[model samples]
Target: MIFKYRKGDELIEQTVVKPYDSVFGGQFDSWNVGKKLSNLTTCSNFFVDIISPSSPDDAPPLATLHFPVYTDQNAHCHVDYLRQFFKIADFCTSGDACKEKIWSTSYPDPKSDIFVGYDEDTQTLI
Candidate 1:
């Protein structure tokens, strides 16, 4: 299926290899895999592309690291890990600019502790 979140953005047509599945993510999801029955998962081929930080957005990824995606034993993917991974990238979780660095930059006034170590629950550094 072809999907693109924004207009004027490139469209990505992904073949449904696993037909029915969702990117449930390993962390921050409403569901838990800690259960003995829930822990059961099947392996699927997944990958992340690493690109040079200096490279342009249009540039091809430098390396593709294939990772294992776990699904339920029932041939249905309960969660999508890639979504979880990318969503994490959309925010900041740091303390000191001179200390903590991410792909990692200090944004919006250069580390005024803006979203430092983003505590979503309390929304505070503490």
Candidate 2:
């Protein structure tokens, strides 16, 4: 999963290599589906919960990402906020024993490296 933030006028993008099983429940599917929207000029934002994606007994859990776009502006805002929160937690906490695995986004794959659009309506990534 790729998360974006605003860095001045440019879009700063990051990638969550491991699936966020605890949050979003359907992360893998989201990422797969996102592959289509990844190249789009715009994307949508939605809510995501933060929790450990792996455990001692259940390590590297799988999840499918599902983003439901609402017509209501308030709902969009709320989900966007939650998504931002999850992005932060994932980046700062990802580790062998952590909940998420976020990275600086390496090259090779256009979806995550350059095309990086997943679910942000404004698309103001930085």
Clashes (backbone N, CA, C under 3 Å), per candidate, total: 6, 18
Best by TM-score: 1
Q: For all the candidates, what are their Cα RMSDs to the real structure?
A: 17.1, 21.3
Per-residue alpha-carbon lDDT of candidate 2 for residues 70-92, written as tens digits (9 for 90 to 100): 33334535556466545643344
- lDDT scores in order: 0.42, 0.40
The count of backbone overlaps in candidate 2 is 18
Residue clash pairs of candidate 1:
22-80, 23-79, 23-80, 24-79, 24-80, 94-117
- Alpha carbon deviation, residue 72, candidate 1 (Å): 4.3
Leading candidate by lDDT: 1
Q: How many residue pairs clash in model 1?
A: 6
